[model samples]
Target chain A: MRGPLSKRLFLWTLVWAVVLTLSAPTFVIIGASLTAGEMLQFPPEGLSFKWYRQLWQLDDFKHALTRTFYVSLICTLLSLPVGTLAAIAMVRYRFRFQGTLQVYLLLPFTIPLVVSGLSMMLFFGDIRVLGQLWPVGVGLCAINIPFMIWSVSASVNALDPELENAAANCGAPPVQAFLTVTVPAVMPGIITGALLMFILAFNEFLVSLFLTDSRTVTLPVQIYNSIRSVITPDLAAVSVVFILIAVVTIGLLDRLVGLEIFLRSK
Target chain B: MNRTLNRKPIAWTLLDAVEISASTVWPFRGRAAVARAFLLPAVLVVGLLLVGLGYIIEYSFHELDITTYRLKDEYSIINYHTVLERPVYLRVLGRTVLASLIVTFLTITLALPYAYVLVRTASAAMRKFLLFALFLPFFIGQVVRAYGWLIILGREGLINAAVTSLGLPTLDLIYTYPAVLFGLIQYMLPFAVLLLIPAIAAIGEDMELASEGLGAHWVATFRYVVLPLAKPGLVGASVVVFTLTMTDFAMPEILGGGTNDFIASAIYDSFFQISNPGLGAALSVILIAVGSLLVMGFFLAAGPGTLGFRSRV
Candidate 1:
């Protein structure tokens, strides 16, 4: 408490040490991806962008990337409205069995991905909807809705209901008041929820593995299959890109809403 | 003023209509309609997942013909018995539980002092930077992070390189128990820090000062004062880390190197590789049961009305 300069220096050093330690892997992968020689040799001799270029050229990786983007995009879009509605209901309503409803809504988050994947596989297979892209989208949407609900609900709790009441009193319809007042008030929450849902869907693998056909194979699934079948610098290259996307997304979120609020809500 | 007056009457008419419909249609009608409209989508999704889970549970107890690759209508407990009686299944289950516990304990231990420092430090910039560093790894993709560890723990990777540079004999670590543990602990440490920071911040500096003024040693103050107050964060963080590690497939699959397997990976293999849906379903049920029990046990141990009780207060 007495010495400010030294304390700051010490704290900075500690932070730098931890960050450097954790970031070593990211650097190593990037270096390995750029290695001129094959076979993932580290200290990765004579760097080049050959592997990265090679990975980009692969049709499967390209298709998987596109599929992953589309699926995550669709899931995020579908989940936002649904999750926002659920959050509003949970926060605004005080009905019987509301607590029970909240628990049920959170059940998807509690269930393991493997179980969810397997269950979806069986259920969809029985209904003849297995091996379709829509089911894969639905599975991702189901898994992501709870996360969106929680985040949006936290923000919803912070909103003042008086604005909506004022609008309604001023000759606005209920839907119009909600659209003009509540929705704008909760936009930050909705954005955060959408970001989370997108990331979850993008990174999802187990569910994709069960629910996706060839037409719907996601990037994570493709990388997973590649890793199992063959060890290549291309997979490492693809992982580098994936990590970059995640890092950029998080950095953007930190800039937009602050990291503390996001973590605190969780 | 005239336009406003005209719109007001129209809006009033709409409200009157809504009121008439609400009163005539049913009791608590307006609220019921609003609630239903809001709750319908969430309830439908939850219902779908529950139905799927219900089917999985039903399938778990039935017999599937190996030759036909079809489910037999006749019910049997053979899958559950097989899971219970087999040494492999039992060993994997025990190991998964043990590994998760170890990882959770390690994460809490490593994160506690770090979180304490982050929250108690006076400098605003330092706190921001520290928190950012802590959350950075979490934002990165899990598979990429796991692969990062694979490189670090590999035969000629960074750890071994450092050891040889220091003139020490290289230790074989990758694909071993230590690798798995290290990967899991690193993966979960950020979560522990995130959870602990708020609780630590909530304690403030006055309590620590008071304890020290009362001549309590640092260790005594931390054990008796800080920890008890931080119990909620500890419980929440531990519950999350334990459950995630318990159900995790990628970490154990990549690091365990055929020498180890968690129940998640086993379930994956049964369903996809072996095509034994019944056995897979049984494994899944067991996994869920174990995870739920662990969470419940943590809550009970932490006491009623504490953290880990429920998401909401």
Candidate 2:
């Protein structure tokens, strides 16, 4: 709509200001990571990689990094096929309690994360698996599988039903037809869902905090410990690493399917 | 395909065996069976979580024995009673709700115009830039972002360093109630914006133009046309931001500096510090109840499609 120039200018300015404020923390963290002198400070005394280099010698950080990868990989693997199947059923079939099932699939998400974490912790304790790392992966998978279903459902909804029918018409059985025809068509959705699940699992903190023991601590948990116990440039260096991964992932996501897929999946 | 499979006899045999076994085992002719098979694995995962919630409900009725670090065998309402009776618990609950409401209000207000411009701007470049900035922090999880705030707002951090150099006293910016709220608003802003974009886009530029053609001012158009059209998105974004902020664990823990505790922090302390699982379980049940109530109330008022779900049933 047409408006006064001054009014339009004001709206743009406010938008830009809010955008900058949203990004300020990342800029500050990166600047602090580059400090030449000791201590975390933005607008560093001089540019140096001392903190980044220091990270190599920290065994705790290294172990936490490996554990994080392990957990996230497990989370992705567990969620991927299950979520894909759920998506296919939800999108391609008529079934009883279909809408109720859809909401039930998102149950882990609707429950507060803290509540989920604590409940899982207690449940795992009862089952005698509280401190094991794989259960943490299981917990992460449960919380994140809904994203997988939603993402894959977007693609399943887009698939041409006639293609699968054609495969069947060619004397292919249902399972073979599905494997050959439907899977490739929905490959993009599967990949997107996997990427999102991996990233979310990698970045998960609260659930990890509740379920992990000292030996099984994940990267985010280690970062929390560092924040509470020590103020170091090393922490800034780790944060810079997280920021870089996020930047790279966003770039990849944009290139692969465009960023709007995120809106669709949500 | 035939030549390659002929050259790899083992692969061809395995594919045949798998297809024959599949047709024999499940007989995908039954469509309901196929659908049930497809749904069973995810339902199992959901089943595990439901059992966990069951455990929480069960544990909430028992009392923890601090000396033994084990809950009493006899189920009682003592844990819930303590949560309701304790002044500290009451205070934390009050603060969490108050802060969540404030953060939800501010995040939605800030997000609306940003979403509008991104959706309505004629310039593609401007829209691209806004999406990048919005999604940047979004991909960076809450814990890392909160840590970033620590480096910027800490005592010897950026703000304090600048303040001291300017011949002014340093400020204690981090680890306060307002600091927690500030961090939460920043964290929730992107989510609000993302949720708002689809709703705002649904309004389309034509509606705004039509209103203007009818001689409505920009403000009047925004109020009468945009606001009413975007109600689902606004409500959706508000509910999301509010519930997330209400149960947030990182911001208050990281920025509140051990003084301004939210309900999540209290739950953490009970379970880990005091070794009281029963109390923690009680708090979790309360939190779950409150969150479900809010969501159910909204679903009643705005419908389930607010979150962009298609109501297939």
Candidate 3:
């Protein structure tokens, strides 16, 4: 079933090279972040945590970091109920244009992030019905709601209808049966989905760029503007911090439900 | 399976009456009716955002009135004409397409063998390591990874340090097209593997054995058997990787320095730098059209190969 010995050996070498290449950036970033030199250098001249210390001293980074967490967390929480209900309707209902609706919600995926960001800017500018932060919140959901729907819908689809019907037959109301039966069954999916969207919103840059004015700057947008103004190891250190946070959370998520779950779109 | 519904509390009975009527009303007596309450919020939000998209599309045909920060009250294809007439835009478009094609090809090619190794390896530890290695980037944001490349490929970056250590000429890898392509391929490799793994996994071991038994060389087996079977994943990964690369903003911006630019960079400049939303809209419309065209090609090439839209059966 395997390839010939030589073929396998050739592939093994290729894979080794690829693994190194894929992982090299993270190591290099970590290494650069530890640089003691004045200029950003790799294979750092001397190891130091000065850059990491410098990040704490910077007001821009502190404020941006707080805003990033606040937005990502709030958006994830806000998106949960709406996304869960939508996923339920999508999975349970047999309706005209259901397929169209699914694609429409996922349209953000196909549309360039920057384009959507521009659209949101024009929109929010026109309609001040909601404050700036609220639109940014909804905009995050604009891109992320589909992910929640997909993740939760997978769990919803996996549930046995018999359980809900049984609860209903036992005189439990429909909402009560759903709360008792369906929600718990899908809790893991919901948890992972929230984590997934949190990471995405936290890391998102281009849309955040358009959404964030002077008043509401996000971490990634701040990092972006700062990088343009000057290149420094302190920025690298900040990036390392962000990556570690994401990696640690994702590590836990992978433990709870394998990354393979994402690979399987269904 | 009979249950005593009559014994339930009046509170529960009252709630059930409303729920039952909602699902069973004359105009709502279908499977879809049961879900009407749940779907209303998402519909409202999506409908609202679509209005934004409508605004952008409306603006693309007009000129920007920068003084007012509003589009001119006119409709024409002049913005598209401007994009076509501008040599820099044309050059960037060509480069973006070519770079995307090359990156997609290389990412998928490299990922195939690595994916096979990861999937087929008998040792659990190796698989775990491979999985860890693959998922590492998912944790790291694209901007961070691009910045990482800035460190690895900068004038005083890792490669330069190594070259100078050897008393050789230091290479300027950053601030160039190759550097952008290199970084993009690294970023996209994991995605390709993720898509390809499921496809390669779908090809049973027995089929490979059967091909080998038929006096076919392993290469021939791969060419005729594995490749064909994995086409769905290949096509899917290709469409995804190419579109992502084409629309990408970070790699080209971070690695391309101030001079080298992609379509996204052009779009960014038109809107943010020049205060020209009309042009920005035109460029975005073009990007979407081109991206959709390419995706259509992939779908035509590999029917049902695309994932995420519908149930398989």
Candidate 4:
């Protein structure tokens, strides 16, 4: 409805405002991490890598970082195959209770993280499965599966079933057809789902809090405990690192497959 | 298409015949069993999760011995009574509901226009960029995002720094109700936008053009044509956002700074710090009940068919 120049300017202005607001915290954390002073001071007296150096010295942070990656990686690996199978079943099979099953699968996504964590704590803690890293990873996997299913299902739905039919018609077994035709066609969805699942598991906190033992504290849990006890530039340093990892991961995913399709599936 | 029998490859032909026979036979006998197998994991996980919730519901009605840190199986409504009797718990519940409602409203209000622009503008590049910007925070953990706001809203944080630099007196917005509200709004904004986009896109441009051509102003057209079509999305987004904010623990814990306590923090304290599982379970049951009632209200208002997309499938 407006001139192209004005429209372009409006779009740019809108975008810049959002980008600035969203990235403001990232900048502040980065700046605070580089402060020469002991406190979290932005626009510091001088830039220094002291906090980054000290971050390594803090064994809790170091351990938490390693544990976080381990748990996230394990969870992602477990959820990917399970989620892919579920997605295939949902897309390929026409059953009487298909819609109901789809809804049931999505229950974890609708429930709050705190509630889920609390429930897992109660269930696992009662069963003495608490304080185990695998159970924690499993709980996170449970949450991630639905999201993985949804994203992959979106891709699966987009795929032409006739390809699988054709493969089967051309003397391929059902399993062979799935491997040769279905998996390749849905690889984008699988990759997108895996990336999102990894990120979710990587950044998960509430579930980790309830399920993790001292031996398996994730980074977000570590940062949270640190923040509660003290206000230090080290927290900012860790936050800066977290933001960078998130940005890089998200940017890579956006480049690999369009972000919009993945997000809309959410 | 390869129905012709190849007698030369006898072994292979027999194997193929066996495979085809098994496949055909399995559909009637084992299809149900296979379907159940495919569904077993989801059912087990969800069933276990619900069982946990059921345990909470059961525990909420039980009596607790503070001295032993044990729950007495004898049924009692004492915990609910305790919650209702204390004005503090009731007040916190009220504040939690109010905060979530306000956050949901603010989220939809801000997101709707921005989403409208995204869909209506038809700028592929801008849409991609804005969509990416919107989803960027999903990458960041909620704890970190809340902590980011803690930095922004603190006394010496960015907001205060900017205000003081302008020679204006600093406002004590942090560690108060508004701080909690602000954090909730920020958290729920992306969800609201995501829900609205598809709904808006589904309406397409013809409706808007037709409304405008009929002498309707942009505002009128939006209220009349666009809003009605987007009601399902609006309802679904509101329910999700409201329930999320209502049960949120970390945001209020970090930003509320002891000035406010939502049901989630209250539940956390009872369950963890106080080691009162019965009381904690009671509080959780109450929270879930309230959340479910709101969801039910949405479903009733929107009617049954519209609740389909609310499943997030």
Looking at model 3, residue B275 earns an lDDT score of: 80
Off by over 4 Å in 2: A1-7, A160-163, A166-172, A263-266, B1-18, B306-313
Task: Kindly report which residue pairs in candidate 2 clash with one another.
Answer: none
lDDT of 1 at B41: 87
- What lDDT tens digits, residue by residue, belong to model 2 across residues A1-266? 24678658877888988988799999988888888988666567899998888998889888988999899999999998999999998888888988788789889878888888877887899999998999999999998888888778878877788999999899876667878899999887888888888888989999999899899999988888878987888888898878887888788877887876644322
lDDT of 3 by residue, B1-313 (tens): 3466547888667767866775565345445666866877777666656777887888899987768977789788889999999998889989999999999999999999988777778876788788888877866778888888877888877789889999999898889989999999999998799778767877787888899899988888889988998887788789879988999898899899866788999998998888888998999899889888887777776763634533243
lDDT of 4: 0.77
Give me the chain B TM-score of candidate 3.
0.87
What is the docking quality class of candidate 1?
acceptable
Please, what are the lDDT tens digits per residue for candidate 4 over residues B67-143? 77798869999999998888989999999999987999888887776676767665678777777677677678778
Considering every candidate listed, which one attains the maximal lDDT? Answer: 2
Write candidate 4's Cα lDDT for A1-266 as tens digits. 32246544654575465556666566677778888998765557699999899988988887888888888888888787778877777766767888788767877766666777888878888898888777777788886687788667778877887888888799987545666788999888888888888888989887888888677788998888877876778888898778887888778787888776633422
C-alpha RMSD in Å of predicted model 1 compared with the true structure? 4.0
What CAPRI-style quality would you assign to candidate 3? Answer: acceptable
Q: Going through the candidates in order, what fraction of the true interface contacts does each contain? A: 0.34, 0.53, 0.49, 0.27
Model 4 regions lying over 4 Å from their true place: A1-19, A262-266, B1-34, B165-169, B303-313
Q: Which DockQ values do the candidates obtain, in the order shown?
A: 0.39, 0.57, 0.47, 0.35
Instruction: List the candidate numbers ranked by lDDT, top first.
Output: 2, 3, 1, 4
Cα distance off (Å), candidate 2, residue B251: 0.4
lDDT per residue for candidate 3 within A160-266, as digits (tens), equals 77888899899876667877788898887787788878888888888888888877888777777777766788888888877788778778777887655654432
